[model samples]
Target: MSMPPVKKIVTWLLVIFLLYAIFTSPSDAANIVGSAWDVIANGVANIGRFFDSLIARS
Candidate 1:
């Protein structure tokens, strides 16, 4: 199966924009990535805590 043309175009545009952002302002990019990582990590931690509480109740 192949991706639709519009989806492919949007993906390419996003890639180009990311590259431009990285090259134009690396510090801002780093901060953005760090923030994204923190969000993901906190989400995973919350999920883990939820399961822990579930198991503790059993």
Candidate 2:
């Protein structure tokens, strides 16, 4: 049997993604924000560590 057309497959995937996001896992969206903040925090912390290492070298 032939597979569904690409447009139909994309639409169905989007529909499923939206349904899952809206109904079953709303907080999952918030984790994206949390992940961004975590990355920011780690970047700042790494910069601080690098500066501290420079001071130690001096």
Candidate 3:
């Protein structure tokens, strides 16, 4: 009912779900992580480009 308890419950649920996923379809989980990494890398690269442009202008 409280926020802290709710957060703990959600975190546990996610951990269980992830464990189930890893046991069932490990390749799928690996793919998901790979895709997530790619998205994060692209975001970082884009931010770097934005800063580079700012520096070039100044």
Residue-level lDDT of model 1, residues 1-58, one tens digit each, is 9999999999999999999999999999999999999999999999999999999999
Candidate 1 global CA lDDT score: 1.00
Could you tell which candidate, 1 or 3, scores higher by TM-score?
A: 1
Residue-by-residue lDDT tens digits, candidate 2, 1-58: 7667997899899998878886776688678768999999999999999999999999
Better of 1 and 2 by lDDT: 1
Lowest-lDDT window of 10 residues in candidate 1?
1-10
Can you give the TM-score per candidate against the true fold? 0.95, 0.54, 0.89
Where does candidate 3 stray beyond 4 Å? 1-3
Q: RMSD of candidate 2 to the true fold? A: 7.2
Question: What are the per-model numbers of colliding residue pairs?
Answer: 0, 0, 0
Candidate 1 vs candidate 2: which has greater TM-score? 1
Winner on lDDT (1 vs 3): 1
Error of 1 at 16 (Å): 0.1
Residue-level lDDT of model 3, residues 6-30, one tens digit each, is 8999999999999999999999999
Report how far residue 11 has shifted in candidate 3, in Å: 0.9
Quote model 1's TM-score. Answer: 0.95
Each candidate: what lDDT? 1.00, 0.88, 0.97
In model 3, what is the error at residue 38, expressed in angstroms?
0.1
Candidate 1 residue 43 C-alpha distance from true site, Å = 0.6
